[model samples]
Target: MSAAPELRRNSLDLPEAVEAARAQYAARRPRSAALHAGALEVLAGGNTRTVIAYEPFPAAMVRGEDCRLWDLDDHAYLDLCGEYTAGLFGHSEPRIHDALHAVLRRGINFASVGPGEEKLARLICGRFPSIERVRFTNSGTEANLMALTAARAFTGRAKIMAFRGGYHGGVLTFPITGASLATLPLPFVMADYNDNDSAAAVARANAADLAVILVEPMQGSGGCIPARPDFLATLRALADETGAVLIFDEVMTSRHSAGGVQARLGITPDMTTLGKYIAGGMSFGAFGGRADIMALFGGKLPHAGTFNNNVLSMAAGGVAMGEIFTAEVAEALYQRGEALRARLNAVGAAAGVPLSFTGIGSMLTAQFRIPAPDRPYVPTPGEEQLRELFFFDMLEAGIYLARRGMVALSLPVADADLDRFVAAVADFAENRAELLRADGVTG
Candidate 1:
């Protein structure tokens, strides 16, 4: 799903260097340029998804193999973007790939329940601490919608308490940039992330009507900013006090551990929403927690979708959870990510740029901010320019990550390839030192 975020914006002008880089970007991707031009006739702005709409046009990739991708221009890339954390097993995982093929052999559109669905559901319920009884959805967006609906149905309330920069799904985004027109019309008590006092205040004010408090353990599109432990604890406490269903949006963060961030932090939520890498890269999402809360479905609060338990996704996701991404592999990949992030941060420091990598485990993002951020977004003047420049620079060196600087390391990404990524990052930090040190840029 290329799954580029509909995250950031552009209002201020970029530096001349960025303009030059953009030109270089156009020069290198002639085939992509023509494809995009042709595509514009049918697709909106050469994209159906909003996130793929980036400055200097997004590259048109033809195919991918284990940790690598080939673009329309024939440029090869080390895929650090990891399909926005959805490609955890990499492009060609034998087990997951085999599962999909096997499903096709069995045929599709089975009108009744399939064996694969029950097996996959058991695996998911076993893995997540919050999910005692689970239900499937086609995407994370759908899972999050159902989660909120369940919360409302269970609590008989109307409002949602979420963070300023939280992103539950396409329709559930509440960016620090501003209100998105596509956001769901559900009442929101938006609170600042990592600010326990303020978040507590807002939660209490809406406690009477707040049915759910949905949040990401890390703000994936909001620059991978993690929620402070105490901030989450405060929310947990507030939910207990207010009778709200605390929903952890682990769509991206679920890849962090075998049980996810809730296990990492040792804080359990009343409900959990999951997607991204969970389905072995097939379109998948699940919502579940506490058996009593999930009983909404049994009470016949309808949750329907034909593909909710499609054998392809269920089979592939079962392979992903039960076979490929086991507890040991999850731990090792996490260590690899920590080491990589540390090295990247060291490179930025040595080059004297206010750049750092943020997020936990194999999923992280490159952030151009001072002293790092505990909040959702700070929105400094030149932050967007720096992010764009860094993106083009990475592309020129054949390392592909999200334009917003998000990186989600996949299981197949080799250590040597990681070393090369670090070297490329060091090169970028060295080359962009002056621009980064410029007063308004990193401030």
Candidate 2:
């Protein structure tokens, strides 16, 4: 019952590692320090996204091209974070850049349908048979809003069922019940992910009021847990039995396959929401499903946004999707992702870190296990310390992955980039874990 062996490498010593990482960051961004000081004067958290803010301060990135990003102080690093999987086509990809530039010249928001909308919509529907019609939005959050509205309209019910740890964009009503969104309530009921029986039981119990069951085919924010196929099939059956809309939020998983997780699984949901890679990093989202369900927006339910299908996003999304999504391209991404996952597993095993990964194609997550059952899987008092150490270590090592340990591979990422990432993991295993142990985070 003594403290278990250290899980990571010597690089993760809590107190020492945090200080070292901050020192390294300060060394690289003298300008960023000044910028943060100035930003804090105006910005509430000195940053827009709360998650991106970290101790000391977050570096302000000035430019990004392809797989690399540069800070205000001119520090360049490989961008493995990809804006949290939104940049699947890479930063400022040529096709997207060109399309965006051209479209911007014409206009940005017309608040009217443009030619690009029809083209992009056609592409989205063509890939996923379940998406017979679609409505565009500016971000994933808006897409979920529309999807939920449609579900409520179609089912004539009030409650939505979401899997625990499943993320369907930030809807205050839906509140992220599982991993992060454990606060809010849509008259929501949480069921264990990858556990179909529990989920089915919840649906049965809540059948009368369940409007829809929203899930991520692969949970990106919730530790990148893959939704078990059987669980999805069972959920589909339950939804059908209870007359609830089955909505799969494929924002993170769309890059994996043309039609997304629904298409990859060869199962159709009554509705689907897509974002992230859809616009090739410029910011776009869409919700589509059966024609009748989607058509609810036309008159029955209201779904309107002046910038929903802005010309630039549509143009960039159309060009990027057309170029990147093909049988050959998808297969190549699959193979590359498998290689990356295998390398990470090897690193974890050697480091004595119980790391597990689940996903298909380019999207994946690395879950670091803690000895405490409620540690990694459920948030414990010390969980924040462990996560902070892991991220600080990884960031110091020059691999810019999320603190939560999610990785999104771009089609542009080649052998060298992949090798660099794997090597970083190995270094962490060999050097970072000791740092974590020294911080009193052992086991």
Q: How far does residue 200 in candidate 1 sit from its true spot (Å)?
A: 0.9
How do the residues 214-272 of candidate 1 rate in per-residue lDDT, one tens digit apiece? 88888998888888888889889999999999999999998888999998899999999
Task: Judge candidate 1 at residue 126 and give its lDDT.
Answer: 91
lDDT of 2 at 60: 81
Q: Which numbered prediction scores highest in lDDT against the true structure?
A: 1
Whole-structure CA lDDT of model 2: 0.73
Off by over 4 Å in 1: 1-14, 439-443
- Residue 160's lDDT in candidate 2: 81
Residue 233 accuracy (lDDT) in model 1: 92
